[model samples]
Each structure stands twice: as C-alpha cells, then as structure tokens.
Target: MKLNKVTLAVGILLATAGGAAQAQAQPVQNIVLVHGAFVGGAGWRPVYDQLTHDGYNVTLVQEPLTSFSQDVAATRRVIEQQNGPVILVGHSYGGAIISEAGNDSKVTGLVYIAAHALDNGETEASNGKKYPNSAHPFIKSGDGYLTIAPEYYHSDFAADLPAAQADFEAHAQMPTNAAVFTANIPHPAWKSKPSWYMVAKADKIISPDLERMYARRARSHMVEIAGASHSVYQSHPDDVAKLIEQAAQNAQP
Candidate 1:
C-alpha cells in the first residue's frame, strides 16, 4: 500500500511540474511594426532584432505608400497572423496607419514613435499646416506621388544620425503618393485602445511641439528623449524597444 501511495505522489508531482512548464512556455506577445512614408519595413531592423532576441514575435509591415487603403490592408494582414494579442507600432507617417489599423480585433495596444496620430477628420497634410516652420522641405508632386527634397534628408529628416547612415537612408527613401497624405483618417483606433508615445525632442522634420500636441491629444503614456531625431527607432533602438516591451506587457490578456 505504501509503495502505491509513493507512486501516486510522484505522478501528482510530475503533473504539476508539467502544468507549470506549460504555463511558463506560453507564447510571448506578438508585435506588428509599421513603418511610415519614405521608408520600408527594413527601417525597423534594429527594433525587430531586439524584440525577437527578447522572445517576442515581431512582424514588420511593408507599407505600399500607394494609398491609405493599401497601407491599412498591409497592416491588417500582419495583425491577423498574430497568435495572441498584438502591439501595433508605427513611426512617422506610420502613426496614421496604426491609428486606423489599431481598430483590428487583435491589436491590443499602440506605440507611436514620432508619428502622426491624427484624430478624426485629420489628414497628414492638414496637420503640417498648423506648425509655423516647415523645417523639412515641401514634398514635390510627380506622377501623382510625393518625394522629399534630397537636401532635407540629412538636415531635417535625420539630422541626428551619423552622416553615412543619413546618406544611406536618403538614398533608400521611398516616394509616397500625394493622395495618401491628403486622405482623411475616418476612424482612429486610439479612441478605444491604450497608447504610448515617444517624443523625439530634437526632431526637425516634425516639430517637437507637434509631437507634444499629438501625444497630449491621444492621452498616451509619453516619454521624451531629449536629443533624439525624427528617426528615434534608428537612433535609440534600446529605448524604443523598451517602450514596445512595456506596451506588450500592458496589453490585455
């Protein structure tokens, strides 16, 4: 009888151990990163690596920059693949994408990095008019698309990056359709979801004041990085990664 009791105790212990292991092995939160205009998913390599290294599933959405609907479709595709809740992050014009895409049922949180989180009835172009200084050169229209002036690449868009990095980014920048910027955001997701914002204090392309304004409007948990430029994800990957992690952790179960 004692032998049988001992065997049963061992079985119970093993079962409990297996249960604990399974609980601990639960999947890490998935993150879908959306890049803004003038760039592709490659721009998120640094953050992507960091998140994957830390055990999060990361998907980089390659926005078409062709139209608002296309960008939203691309973002939705990524979000749909996530196994559990997802944190959708957008940088620059990507903010607009997230604002719309965050409405997806899988997206549990949002992180806006120097992005344009415009509310209802706002377009990217209209938001720019509110600021006094157009520190960044006006985009030229060609073939129904928009391209940034090459000169503004180093001084305005990525002033804080090393010269070589800035040059490479300029060369790699993608041209977006003019119609995308003028497209009004009909429904903004931040209206219903929890959000975080990173304000690049030294950003020249988008005014720091505008960043503050957007963050305030979104009622996001805001963090200000004093010397970072518009490309905060590239310049300070660790900081951005930490914020992404926090957003993931705070996501609903």
Candidate 2:
C-alpha cells in the first residue's frame, strides 16, 4: 500500500536524522495545523488547547487564503521550523494545502478534518463533481473570492453550532479566492504518507460521500462523526484531538 510505503519512508527518514535518538525512542510530538479558507488559525484555538494539554507541541499555521500555492507555502514554512517528525493536519480547503506541503521530508503523516483530500491534479471543486456540496446555495461569491452569506452560515454551513456563534463566524470569515479551487495539485502528499480523515456526517459544504470517496481512495484511517458540522474543529475538538493524537503515536519511529 502506498500509505504503508510512505509511512515507512517517514520512519526511515527519522532513523537517518538522529541515529542515537531513534535508538532511545522519539514519539514525534510535533504537530502542524493548517486552517481552511474563510477561517483563520483562530478557529483552531480549541483544538490547540486540547492537543497542548495532552503535551504535544502544536503549531497552527495561519494560511494566506490568497491562493493554493500561497497556502502550501505557508504550511511548508511551519513544517520547516520543526526539528523532527511532524503530523500535518488540515481542515476543509486546508486539506489541499497540506496535500502539497506534507510532501516535505519532516512530515510523517496527515490528518484531514472534514476536508477536501484531493488526489494529484485534483482541485477542491473537482472533488465535488459527482457529489456536489449541498451548501452551494449558501455560498456567495464576489470579486474572485468566496464566503458564506450570514443568513446561510447559521443554517446550512454550521447548523449544529449555536446560532449566535455561527452568525459571528460568518461575519468574521475571511474571503477565500474562488480561483483557489482551480489550482492543480502536482504531487499530493497523501500518496506518499500515512493519512487519517474525519468525516463530518452532517457537513453541507462538502458532501459526506465525497469525503468518504477521498478517504477510501487514499486508504486513510477514517472516522465518522455523526451530526458534526463543517466546523468540527470547534464543535468537537476532543474527537479531533484524539484522531490527531492517534496519528502522531502511530507515526512514531
């Protein structure tokens, strides 16, 4: 399996980087998180707290929603700072970013949270060809950017969230370039790394079927969270943290 091959490659890299430490045992505590478009790294606050409390060194990368390449670059910058093995995690469109950035030698594994884990040359929008996102009607575009209208954010995008909180998120969302989805993926990191995915069964932004398809195709260790919204990172931080911790532990050298 490609996942096994690449994951072993991670261990090999670890063995080569610090021979003495590999003999002593290193758990790969480093974790880098990438946020999706429209939301900033602040959305990861709850998840960060959970992971940090568990004693993992977590770094949340604030992606530039300007472009897919820019987002990938931002993620790579964070990965570059890590001294050892890392588990790269992404949410929503951030999945695409990590798909590229996780190719880095330092990355040992990947975790996708209600995200678009597309294959090589695949785009986020392309992942929806068969199972289009149910929340399309809720999305409003402007000047090459996209965002959820305040009216639809509460109902369609985050129905599981408190109405007031959903409304606030909608209002504070950063605009994401509509063109970002058109960018082609060259070498998806998942093809060469162990992957895990969380399916938000109640997500409207990206169909659950599509999420399943991607996870299955990548041979990801998949978990389904019933009634979780697109904002599962905020709504169900504990489960998200558990999945991430599992990835980190399993990826250990």
RMSD of each: 4.6, 8.3
Which parts of model 2 have CA positions greater than 4 angstroms off?
1-25, 138-142
Cα lDDT, model 1, residue 137: 60
Question: Candidate 1 on 1-253: residue-level lDDT in tens?
Answer: 9999999999999999999877755543899999988888887899999999999989999979999899999999888888888899999889999999899888888999998898888877787888543465657675787766777787777777898888888888788987887877777988889899999998876778888898898899999998888888898999999999988877564
| lDDT, candidate 2, 54-124, per-residue tens | 99999999887988878888889999998889999999888888888888999999999998887766777
Q: TM-score per candidate, in order?
A: 0.87, 0.88
Candidate 2 local accuracy as lDDT?
0.87
Please list the residue runs of candidate 1 whose C-alpha ends up more than 4 Å from where it truly belongs after superposition: 1-28
Error of 2 at 12 (Å): 24
